[model samples]
Target: MADDLLLGIDVGTTNIKALVFTTGGALAASASVATPTERPHPGWAEHDPHTLWQAVVAVIRRALASIDDLRRVRGLAVASVGEAGVLVGAGGEPLTPIIAWYDQRSAPYAQRWKTHDDPLETFRATGMLAAPIFGIFKLQWLRDYEPEGYAAATTWLHVADYIAFRLCGARTTDYSLASRSMLFDLRARRWSESLIDRAGLRGDLLPELVVSGTRIGAVTPEAAAETGLAPGTVVGAGGHDHVCGALAANVRRAGDCLDSMGTAEAVFLPLDDIPLDERLFIANVSSWTHVTFGAHVARDRYYVMDGLFSSGAAVEWMRRLAAPGASFDEAAAEVETLAASAPPGSMGVLFLPHLAAGERGAFVGLTTSSGRAALARAVYEGLAFEWRHMLDTIEGMLGVRARTIRAIGGGTRLPVWLGIKAHVLGRPIQVLDMDESVALGAALLGGIAAGVYHSEDEAVNALQIRERTVAPDVALHALYERIYREAFLRLAPTLAPVHTALNDLEMI
Candidate 1:
């Protein structure tokens, strides 16, 4: 029983990681490698599928090397960044490079779709905003720019699906990943026929969809040889990396929320049913099927998700700008020390963290006395305020407040940031001790597929989750409450005109 192991491979934008865990939820071994992204042209980002596969293989082999018996590994699954996918040919070869989700090369196609289609109708069907990040737009980009490859492609597989296919020889995808494609019918839980027709894509371009945690197939001999996994090891369906991480954190019930802090941050709040509010669309909040399902969790559950494009990214940017050549930990430590010295409101300085296209980040009310400490503190406060804004918007639309906010990912390593977020939000932030929640969620799914656990509830119950709560500081909370409402909330609207003017200047 102790020998039974589950392997979870997470294909992230930053790194590819393989983690092994026992059925009882204790970590056994792990390995990771940086994910290589190619920027062939400005605004274009892609990953060679072959290179990604090799990285996955290398991590898997390296992780399994610590185990005594390969056959003890019962099941494996993969969780990956959503919306990025590769087109596969009839013979299981990649027809096109995997497009990065954040790439803006498909903007024209997305804009065209927005012009032609009713956005409300699109939102009702897909529960996502019209963005170039969606897989459908990337497919459109391929259809127009690389017609030959698009024509030859038989199936489009999400990053996780592609890796799983390579491992188990299955051409299938899971619902949570499919939801990110912007081609799925959220209510019907299938591909939207009208959207597929509108996009000028073959209806069959997508693969068969399965729920996350469903057993798909077993690792083939070829895959076993490449990854040091036992041949015939059961393979399970996995979902989007964020959803998988949420699952591991046990944010499955209605009213439960997860703040996934990474290169980009997202706030996930699971709901019992879809909210038919147009305001959610306007706010850029997405409602989609969560990785949660079964008799344990609500079967008809969805989640409202939105966040800052630059939560942790803003901090990283500051680190690079102010503490060049310093390691991340070193920079973070300096930031923590400096930020702690600054007062609750960052010494009257305000940071508007809008790092997206057409928007510029700014530090207002800066004086000669303002130093890196106040500037860094302002960045942290700004990130917290932005998340508060997003959460407030979601709460207003949903008519429900999150009862619990669980924090996960790299950003949680920053104690000062966590404390600032807690104080700013006026709520306790539960930081999970699990370092790799996404991979652990994948492992839990693998456990289900391998029959090591009977259900999602049982699999989750097996996890040894330990958490410490960062309670809000009362005095700091009051100070942040006033600052957030007065300064931080107005910062965006105040800078909108300037951002537009700057964009126009760039164009001229």
Candidate 2:
């Protein structure tokens, strides 16, 4: 059984990756392909379901090619971005494209829903903040704009659920993924019939919900032939990518937190039960089910989550503007060299990373001597400041401080940024050895379904997770505490009216 392998497929915003790992947590092989996002109209984004399926197949086959004996692969599962999903027809074809989770095209629908319903009631039932990023709003958009497709659809499946359905012909969704739909009841752990009826959606449009790691079915012959997977290999359920990453990082307790910094960054903290307090709704924090059950240490747990829309995206934008034509490594090196030479706090420069609609990023207090390095450092500091502010809000609302914060994803590669974050937060950060935590978490679930591990703890113990702590600099932390309290904390409130005025002009 030492040779037994598990496969985890991650359907991310930028790429789709298939990672094969041994039961003991050593990676065996991996392959990745760009995730194609089509923008047919401004402010709208989508993924062609067929094209996505093809990419998944390609990555699976490409990764498995390195293995000597395919029989050693015992099980597979999928994890993906939440909220974005495709509606499927009765004949098992996608009725509509998978709408990108960040698409703003559904904003009008979300606004209409907010006008008709009490947002507090909705938040109480769904544990969501009633945003356009939720699946229910996307469904409403499709219902009105693409009536034929909406009428013909039999079920709606999240990205990971759709991939699993394609592999094994099962129509099911896990609780963690379903929690993002804005149609699920958080306390009842089921789709809300009242909300569905109020939204005028079909009663049966959603799939049956199950806990993560459940073995839905085996890989079908057709899928096996296409992807080089063994026929009848167990296919287990997976959940939202961030939740899976938390699982891999062992962030399963009340005080443990996972800082998943990728294209978008999420701060996830598990809770023992759902909090229906109005403070969470006001703070824009979401309460949702964890992707855990059945012998897991965090079984039947809930989590409070929130995030910045553009964390790594802001860094990538800076790379394009400041280090054009430079490789990412080259740009990163430049940033490191310049930042180290420059003073802390980027020499009085401050950046506000609001690169979304209605607001633009700004670099205030820049002097004639400020250069690209200073600008890059300011960006990192700005992000850290924002995260500290967010954490403060979360802790204030929940009355629970994050005892241990584990950092994961692409941003952890930047040592300077990690140090800045540690100083800004005035807390030590634990950086994990594993980069592919999301995929690894899904693979662990697959291992569970295959009987390779008896429980989540066993799977995690096998990995023997290694981490290094990034402790804060006391002197830098003291300085950052003052700057954050005085200037950075006031930026958003002072700029809100200006942003609103600009948005008004754009509308006109």
Candidate 3:
């Protein structure tokens, strides 16, 4: 039924949003609630699991009220930021708060990263970089720092799965979410017993794994009453936010890639094989299973991802600093226009946007001539240069040139920034018009589970989305390649010691 709606819930780090889409892929209604993250101590980020779940329920109720006929809504699915999962007790109540991925509380484990197993072998099994950003280390943090909570915990559920469990009483996670835990075996399509033992975790406490698009169950009467959803309305497991967003962006083949320009700008590539390239480590990239059990996009392909943790956040920072009186839309327009007026390379001034984690943003070669526009342009170019660096690493591994890069999120709205990214990558950048791609993706997966769509590909096609492709300017590309090779690429290494000093002094 065209009128039948699919509900997609996106539990992001900053906000929890619920969106409803028609079977024909039209967005019917939407509502959002801000998600307040707590930072009690330095380098710690936490969220109260029950508080977040209550916000999820509130958003759904608000979104359901957006339309007059709520009965038209059918299945529902949830997507959440990866790595931040909920630790629930034996009775399915939360035992500990969800740890934010950016939280550096687990950084101490990196010193003994290979304590239990070979690092390379662990990567081969989990396809996750040995970093504190993953869930496994967070679990270790709990066991070591909060022993009592660890002792009481029964199941560790990814943020999406925890919400799904509350909705339908199913403790299940999909392949995409499971892979981020650094416990799931990417190739074997199950939890890695050896890795689990090495991490001193029991497989029994892990949520049961399921393929994405599988109808796990339906919203329970308790969930329905709280959120105004119909009891027994179908629901399904969902994937990582970027993976689900890729589905809406039509990233389904080996050459397909997505540049999610959000709070953090992430680069995604579909791979046909488990990438064994050690250079990926050097480049800080990691591979993982697609939402489907096997390779993503196609049956034989997988996916790899890398990111800059400060993308849109940098823009927001600049907006507050350079254009405080301007509204967001006004500031964005000003930046776009300024980027056009200020030449490439930000007029010989380079900006490095390592703005998070107690690190300061740098603008070297700043002279009296530097202005707000120049700094803004430098920010755009700096992020674009980083994007090129990640893509270069992927290209080096694949030994093939990319044709186009698909981009999503609010960053796509800035034509100048998209143009800068296109020129830096030397490829066309295509941005889809799907306003709620992530939530729509979750809902589309719900549609598939409800038998509204036959498959993932069909679910994507049902949107019938056509995108605008930003073509690279040949001269601009050449100029960016030269500037990137000469200056921007060298800034990070040279500043590492400076960052270390700042951290040591508590001066950041």
Candidate 4:
């Protein structure tokens, strides 16, 4: 199996990674290095695309150093946090800093586009809701804010597409990444020229959309020399990190789902068709192409994503602010001990976990008696409850049931949170064996593109490995049911006024 080696690269919000995988479905060697992002102003996040490209080369070189038989590595793929932007010049140099998906400077700009006449028609055409994080608005914001830069822009590319351009000297994005941009018509499976025009951007700026796992090209000799990899190694189009992570968890069918608790908690599941429900707007049902076989067939197989947008992020904030010296484990441990001491409902003190900007769950009586411990427990409970609400909301829209949910990411490392999620959702949760499944999934796709696997299913079968399963506790389930009912009935409705007042205050 040393004869068949594949490399997968993941460029994420905070780090860049390269994983070397053996053809026999094992991680042979890996390397990771931090990618820098600058916060120039409040609510703005920017990364120098050149820095990321260099990090990618660095990790690949380090991984190659660890592998004795470098000649065996035949293919590579790059998975990244998908956001649309421009890569310019003769070699696709970025004209400006890459705007992150988390940047909210374009929020109000996106809001205006959302309220444009014929919003539903436009939405149906694009298969995505207009949002600041979706990249279409970012492009509009770019045109509006930096008209000079827009004119100078030569080629617009998604992060993965930009990385591919660096390695193979070509431009393209997989359907999954394209679908995230709100520029691609998910149903039509192409760039929506109408939407592009509406956003005041040129349609030609977008890269060609390919299905994941298709070889875009071989790594250029220059790229190989810089990265210490053999020239002409195949490079495949990879999907978004979240979708790749789901594939890493072995989520193939409709019922196979993953609850990834990163900074935010997202529930991803495969669906047989495009969910055409008005409630998708209310429930915030976002869809992406399957990592493989994403073509629409009278129906399309999609990955439906529902998330709180803020979960572990909230916990991280609390730990940083309140317990400056405490590690996450220590903070969580403190929360558990204190929560056990406190009453079931945090002593009538309700916390709305809208710590950042968005609110997903509810609240009740607010008293000063709610100490830090109660607030901590509330943050944890609120996140769990929000996931519960999202699960129900997604099911209502799909008109189908998810038999079980698998937990992945750093969150799964916490048995307590995993237990809380399972009890709150009333379902068994399985934890994937692999860490960095996103990179692994990307590697598997590259392997297929290089002809290491006969089919996508075979690739998945060879790659996925289950770690353990956590079943719901009946006693905890009953208690959580009572709490969820009270939280939904009295907590959610009561928080509307508080939320309004909080918005008025602008405390953050």
Candidate 5:
């Protein structure tokens, strides 16, 4: 009985990460490999599926190499960024570059669905509004725009399912990742034939759906050779990155929310019922077996997620403009110090923080009086304000005040930003110590499959713990309330016009 370790792999937006953890949730070793995206045309982002698999294999190999015990690994689990889609031939050879979730090339196809006035019904059925963020839209785009590629495809796979198929020879998707495809029926928990036909998607393209803890298959000998893990290690179907991160943060039930601060920042609230507010829109963040065993979350209990899609992106953009030559850590540190010097409002400079298109949180005002520090502070404030707006809407829907908000991911590295978030949201922020919660959450799925844990709650209780809590300063929170109100007032009316103009400019 070798001391078993669970291995988890994640194929992320800009990096591939592999983590090994004990059943007790202690990280033994980890490795990361940078994976770059290609934009061959405007509004299009892609990565060769082969490139992603190689990256995953490299990171896993590195992680295994770092550890002295090779036979101790019990099982493997995979979690990947959802919505990026890969087309595969009957034999599993790549037929097209993966159209990533961040890719906007599918916007026209998504727009067509809206034009047909068919999105709402689909939303009601699937629990997700059709958008370019979904893999199904990209599949439709391939069918329409790249007829040659579509004709050659036999399977349309989400990034995680594709990787699982390649490594384990199982074309299986977990409940969470499957829910990201708008063609999936949340109530039925399967691909909706009607939705598929309506979207002009081939129903046969989808893989069979499985629950999170189900063992899909064993890693192939070839994958084992490439990754240096034990042959025939069980591969458990994991979940979407955000959902896994939520699990890692211990947000498995109603009233618990998670803030994942990465390239994008989002606040995910798991509800026992679809929140009842007209102002807040419900989209399926990720779906899994309900919090309780043998029980499914009713259509009402689905996850409602709202995001500042450009929040962290805005921060990175400001960092580059403010500290061009500094490392990310150095730049974060500089911004932290400079932001501290500026007042709560950044001296009346309101930044909408919409550096990226197709998302909200646009920065509004800039003047000569606004120094780099002011801009930095405005960037931070804009993100905080964006969160505040979303949280307000969520509370309005939930009709209750949330007590503490759970925060996770790399951005929590900065206390200054966390403090600002606390002040702006007017809630205590509990920061989880694990930065790679997504990978850990995927590993938790492996633990469940390997029979190390009997239930999700038990697994979470044995593993997840809050590391620190940040209480908002009264004065700062008061000042931020005023600033955030004014900032929203100044920016709200401008959103439609600015977005329209941006669309026009992009078209021209």
Candidate 6:
């Protein structure tokens, strides 16, 4: 009875999720398991690739075990958090632990790139700013610090690509994932060989290129035995989790954007043109290959992305500190209650939530008058301010102002937080009904590759996009504008000395 089901395995930083859906576009079953991130040393965040692979297999098997019949699965693909990857040795095994984007071990490497002349050229080629969060910088870190591991590696692969290779013996990566590496040529739709050589990286380390939804291969017999997939179950190419999540949220066409709120908050707009807009590049927002390329796209279409990296993480941290041992739902309720009573300015406290490893968050303008509720409200407002800042920066780059933003993921569940974002950004937030849009997007891609849908457009049209609009309170807009300009905007620069000291002491 379950024979026509499609599967989506989302490998996220906090957890791994698997969703099974019928061809009729109804959810059948879903399961998830924690995927722990390990911090073995200062400024390093990583996960053993072998253990990650085992977790993936176990999660997939557990999800499939609940189905009435294992043969019901038609196809599946992996969606993963961007910018984390590992290298494979000659025998096609992991040579090193996967370095997470949150890891700052490569911070110095990114700093060194600042001395390059005409930085716009690198941005034009890769569509990425020179940051440690990019995969190239992480690669440089590994090569410089762990030369043995680098030498042992025969191929370097992003998270989704490695899972794809495991399931189907295909060593290929999609453009959407490749674009996050700062090594892919946006115009060429391939790896930048010149940049690779310049970085002293082996040209052969990269995977073969593939379009996002193409059928890489069927589940191998070995994979089938390990997991519960049928031997012939299709495996399709997938990309970054946010891009895939956007696909399900219908973030296409001009002026369309998706606000995906997970541990991080991602805001990206589907762009039809890939002009190396020096202005946009200089603004520092990233332009990347979209997950689903249109039929007419010839290496020239992309999505412009900007985000609040610690948006959800900030709130979560505050919740734990404010009320230890409380569930997220319980903490969220408390924050909402307090935020509703508190004014828009968070009572003069400006919390900077972008503290790096070993660095604790700072609350500026704190006085003896400050209480826990004010601290909680400050965290909420800080996240909203960052979101507003991202919108301003990305809007300037894209030259299109969004009147409506489609929101998805866990953050959408909190109405109070959504209201704060809506008020701060001064736009109507269309919060989607589904919390698992990332999983749904992955299944959509798998369905396309399996011939269940004629094309990406058809698959998107079939998605059940139930949502409610959260409109901004006109009065709060003026109040937030003042706070954003005077308090939130001034705090970062004012604390530059603290950040500098933290870095110098090697404590952050």
Query: lDDT of all predictions, in order shown?
Result: 0.84, 0.85, 0.80, 0.72, 0.75, 0.79
- Compared with the true structure, what per-residue lDDT tens digits does model 1 show for residues 122-191? 8878777677888889888889888998899999999999999999989998888888888888778889
Error of 2 at 20 (Å): 0.5
True-vs-predicted CA distance for residue 448, candidate 3, Å = 0.8
Please identify which of the two predictions, 5 or 6, would achieve the higher TM-score against the true structure.
6
TM-score per candidate, chains pooled: 0.95, 0.95, 0.94, 0.89, 0.92, 0.93
Candidate 3 TM-score versus the reference: 0.94
Winner by TM-score: 2
Each model's Cα RMSD: 2.9, 2.9, 3.0, 3.8, 4.0, 3.3
Which pairs of residues clash in candidate 2, taking residues 3 or more apart in a chain or in different chains? none
Check candidate 4 and list the clashing pairs: 88-93, 363-491
lDDT of 3 by residue, 1-508 (tens): 6778999999986789999988767778899988868889977899998889899999999999877776677788898888898778878889888898788888777547856457667766777657777788899888888788788988889999999999999999888888788888888888889877887876777889887778999989999999999899999888788778887787877777788888877778877677554554434333211111223422334787777778888888877776679998887887787778897888798988877644566889899999888988998998898777777766765675566688888788888888888899888888887767889888988888888888876777778676898999999999998999988778887777887788778833
Per-candidate clashes come to 0, 0, 2, 2, 13, 2
Off by over 4 Å in 5: 275-301, 357-362, 464-466
lDDT-better candidate, 2 vs 4? 2
User: Model 2 — which ten-residue stretch has the worst lDDT?
Assistant: 288-297
Return the lDDT, model 5, position 235: 83
Best by lDDT: 2
Per-residue lDDT tens digits for candidate 4, residues 131-233, read 6787787888887887877777767788888888889987888888877787777777888888887777877677777888888999889988899988888
For residue 44, model 4's alpha carbon misses the true position, in angstroms, by 0.8
Q: Give the higher-TM-score candidate: 3 or 4.
A: 3
Q: lDDT per residue, candidate 5, 1-508, as tens digits?
A: 1277888887887678999988767889999988767889876778988878888888888898877867677777888877777878888898888887888877887788768955456666666555677777888878887788789878887888888787789887876777777777776667889988877778888888888878788888988888897777888888888778887787767778778998777777776654222222332222110111011211123576666657677777777787899998887788888888887788778877665536545545677788878878887877788777766666655576666589898889878788888888777988889888889888878777767667777677787455899888898888888877755645756576777777788778
On residues 162-281, what C-alpha lDDT tens digit does candidate 2 reach at each position? 999999999998888988888888788888998998888886889998878888899999999999999999999988998888888988888998899888887788888877767666
